[model samples]
Target: MADIEPYENALDAIPGAHPYPRTSRYHDAEIGIHRQADGTEVRYAKRRLLPPIEDRTGDDTQSHTVRTGERPDLLGRRYFGDPGQWWQIADANPVLDPRELTDEPGREIDVPLAGHFPRSPQGDRRG
Candidate 1:
């Protein structure tokens, strides 16, 4: 057995530490442990499923032209009022790399209105 950290997230069922960055895209992701043959416990955050492009974008979405020297953190603050929520901007765009959205000036990017995803980590859109 290896050293293990403890946790008390009300949403989590397993006994392990939750991921850092409470506002991160992986905030609600479950903690997984891989037991090696040597009994070493490798803990990792499970994969986070991105919401559908359509769900994240709609007629209400805002289109902003990227300016030179602009960054996602700043954009997040401008839009969501929290720099850590930058992932919301990334989710609204189609670019695999969020940095690319700001790399070139004059590129229009989609800014979803008030984050389009649900409160759950599973992206439960059944409602």
Candidate 2:
């Protein structure tokens, strides 16, 4: 005779199962960040005003060109002191492309004010 054990049906029936595999606070400078269920967007909090970027363009080769449009990763290394943190800078500026960070002669994107860039519904800062 062979011994057999009963089979478990639901996932909850299994022992040692944790509910949340990951936890996040979602702390963004922008307040309008929230989740969408069906087709409508719901605001979680009031939008926070971001500091405007100071126009620091000097009398050089380029004029009327946006400076915030520069590569984010490089700016991250320079500003945040972390190259990996580039996405943070990029997220704050949706007009710029992430891949273009390494592109020579980077494209001119509208410089975001020093203030926090609006986060997308998907949580990605990319335009």
lDDT score, candidate 2: 0.40
Over 6-124, each residue of candidate 1 has an lDDT whose tens digit, in order, gives 33333245444345544567776666899999999998977777766754435647889999999998898998888877888887778889898799999998887773444544742
Top lDDT hit: 1
- Which numbered prediction scores highest in TM-score against the true structure? 1
lDDT of each prediction vs. the true structure? 0.71, 0.40
Question: What number of clashing residue pairs does each candidate have, in the order they appear?
Answer: 0, 4
Model 2 agreement with the true structure over 39-123: per-residue lDDT tens digits: 5776564443332334223221122132554555566566546565555544433335676543545344332333233443444
TM-score of 1: 0.71
Total clashing pairs in model 1 = 0
Model 2 stretches astray by more than 4 angstroms: 1-72, 92-97, 122-127
lDDT of 1 at 55: 49
